[model samples]
Target: MASSLTKDSATPAPEKTFLGHPIGLATLFMTEMWERFSYYGMRALLVLYLVSGGADAATGSQGGGLGYTAAISTAIYSVYVALVYLMAMPGGWFGDRVWGARKTVAIAGSVIMVGHVALALPGQISFFVGLLLVAAGSGLLKANISTMVGHLYKGVDDPRRDSGFTLFYIGINVGAFAAPLVIGTIGETVNWHIGFLLAAVGMGIGLLVFLLAGRTLDPKSSQVPNPLTPAERKAVIVKGLAVAAVVAVFYTAVTMAGMFTIKWALYPITIAGLIIPVAVLVRIKRDKDLTPGEQGKMSAYIWFFVAAAVFWMIYDQGGSTLSLFGDKNSERSLFGWEVPTVIFQSLNPLFVVALAPIFATVWVLLARRNREPSTIVKFSVALAIVGASFFVFAIPLSQTAGNDTKVTMWWLVLIFLMHTVAELCLSPVGLSVTTKMAPQKYSSQMMGVWFLAVTAGDCITGLLGLAEVKMNGVGVILFQAAAAALAGLAIYMYRKKVDALVEGTK
Candidate 1:
């Protein structure tokens, strides 16, 4: 797959630009940084806003929450997160099959901004509408953006590729780290609507940065990696639109009929999430066009994706369940200042920022001696780390008398550190390998499929929120930790088989 690129954008970049990576890194780095700030900032406020209606009646809520029960709020969170990942499939397909990644990203960013703006408005209609837009837009932007990062590197085996992704991940954290400090504080202390407005402004800035700097990225990023014929393009577009329209109508009818609420929306969302990747896998496995090696790579890729999703299912709680824990259970005051609970959401990104470079360097060093862990092995490590974090977090539960009792900050801090280590082991590796393993013709689409791991996990997370474990009790935490650990270990035990399946990729 080659890009139809402009000459100016394709000019040979200096080898040592942007801390020894391509010049394009600066462009994507800033864009992703601000986008993440917008995302995490808004996410930090969601559950809090949902649950705040029950906050101290005397003092009143900063913006008065939606007054939902924990289960309902968490269900909404799970669905939104799941949709964001699930939508990326078509978003990736659109980029690969129709509009170029550059255009897809720009359009998606604009749509996301619209979502944020709508969220700034009060009322349930605007709220759900806003979440829908943001999820759809994010789906389009994310996989394509990550794909563009891979395009900047020289080749599949490029030594700097992992490092570049790590740096990009760092850019993600820069925004994530600051969002809580800025957006979290204001949203918690002042007004929820104001906080949402700030998120919109942040995305607007991100879009502007992307337009200005992204132009300097490899021109190949602007062209479809695999160009389609006129007939193919028309067929895909028409079918996509028709299918989307029908689904939208059916969904709306169900909702307006009172047979559906935001909570029940998960049924469709989860079905879509599972179906997209499975369909893609079927396509890959059955495609006569692919060589045997390509088929093996796809199988291995699926295993890694499943493991990554398991890790994410645990890691994602940072925003949903762990968030409420920080707000209600963890001690919020630091040196006499009342800390906004949202600030705790910053911990994982903060750890990623501090640790990513070290991990990148370690991988580079290990690769020199052929000592680096295979992608699958790293995934196992990630699962163990996150599972352990939960177990550690759960240990203190026996001491607390009530859900609101304050636990020490180190308990949460330790968990973030553990989760961050798990993330480092998995996130950058997954991003780098997806581009490497995908068949060239379907590269972008495959990247989107890979995100189905998150899609599956998020769907399950929503359902899990409705379960007894929504807020971690001793039983819930222990079971979750054990399940993830066992899953990781099971994968690790099959490392030899998984490695053989991906030999062509390596």
Candidate 2:
């Protein structure tokens, strides 16, 4: 699977530079920054808007919400986010084999802008349509734009590659950090639709930047790496339509049967999320192209995948469970002015921006001393730290149960800080390991496999939110904390076996 990321050694490097890297870096940086602004901006409001009741006729209070229950709102949020990631696989495929990276990104960005516009419109039909469009568009744009960034570098061994990615990463967090403050404030205080319109404007700016400056990007990025033959293209179209037909028929049948409630709708998605990864792993293991050593590494990668899924299941609760808690249970008063709940959503990215470099330096210092933890150990530590963060929250919730007391905002801040630390340990290392351990023949597909972990984790998070609503919230948090900690311990117990299977790839 040749990709835009794989540079041709024979091609000459570009001479024009920006910030000591290719000039195209700036184009991509700005584009991704604003794209994230749109994404996180809307995300900050999604659940809050869904659960809000616009105004109480009796009390004359200001409110503009759909008034869905917490469980339903969380479930919708989970499905929306899960589908966003799930689209990455096909998005990458379209970039690599059909439209090429640059074109796919340009088209996808346009779609995303339109999606945001739809979201800004009034009515439930428009809201649902907007979610679908944004998910589809984001799926296409996210992976391909990152691919374009890699294309800017000369090759795998480019000395500036890591630094370039670091700069690119900062763009992501910058957008994420700023979005909630700007969009959240407006959405919570004024109108949710207006906030969504602002998100549209953000994406529009990204698209304009990309369109004007994209020519500076590597020309190879515009070349389809594996152009399909006309016959193959027709076959793909036929297969796609067949799949769409099957889905439409199934949906119609379920709707007619009156078995298509929100909870029931989630069952199929959760089942698919659980099953797809197992099927992918089985297929990879059965591939005759892999050597026995590669097969062993595949087995080891499965462990890492499971650990990552567990990690994201807890970490992504920041948007659903954590956001809800912030809105309902956290004290928002500051100088007699109430703060918006969505502002707390900014904390994770804020911490990520601040802590990433420090963690990088620590890793380097540890490596120089030959005292760096192994990949498995780092993963175990991440799970434990994140789980413990929740445990920390659980204590406060348990003590405050059945009372009107609101916890201080500092508690949520502390949790975000801890989550950032765990992310640094696991997320980047997980990406590095996926590339290192994947069988050469299936490398591109392995990236898709990695994203499936996120999909699976999010699906599980939605299901757990329902459970949290039904059972005691404090008890559910304690159970999740215990489960995560035990998962970490299990990984540690089998560390030696995993290390052997990985065969020194790390």
Name the best candidate (by lDDT).
Answer: 2
Deviation in Å, model 1, residue 185 alpha carbon: 1.5
Best by TM-score: 2
Q: In angstroms, give how far residue 153 of model 2 lies from its true place.
A: 1.6
What's the true lDDT of residue 10 in model 2?
A: 50
Q: Output the TM-score of candidate 1.
A: 0.87
What is the per-residue lDDT of model 2 for residues 438-486, given as tens digits with 9 covering 90 to 100?
9999987788889888888888877765553622278878888888899
Q: Which stretches of candidate 2 lie over 4 Å from their true place?
A: 1-15, 54-62, 256-259, 466-472
Q: What lDDT does each candidate get? A: 0.81, 0.85
lDDT of 2 at 218: 96
Each prediction's total of clashing residue pairs, residues at least 3 apart in sequence or on different chains, is 0, 3
Candidate 1 residue 357 C-alpha distance from true site, Å: 2.5
Show the lowest summed lDDT stretch of 10 residues, model 1. 54-63
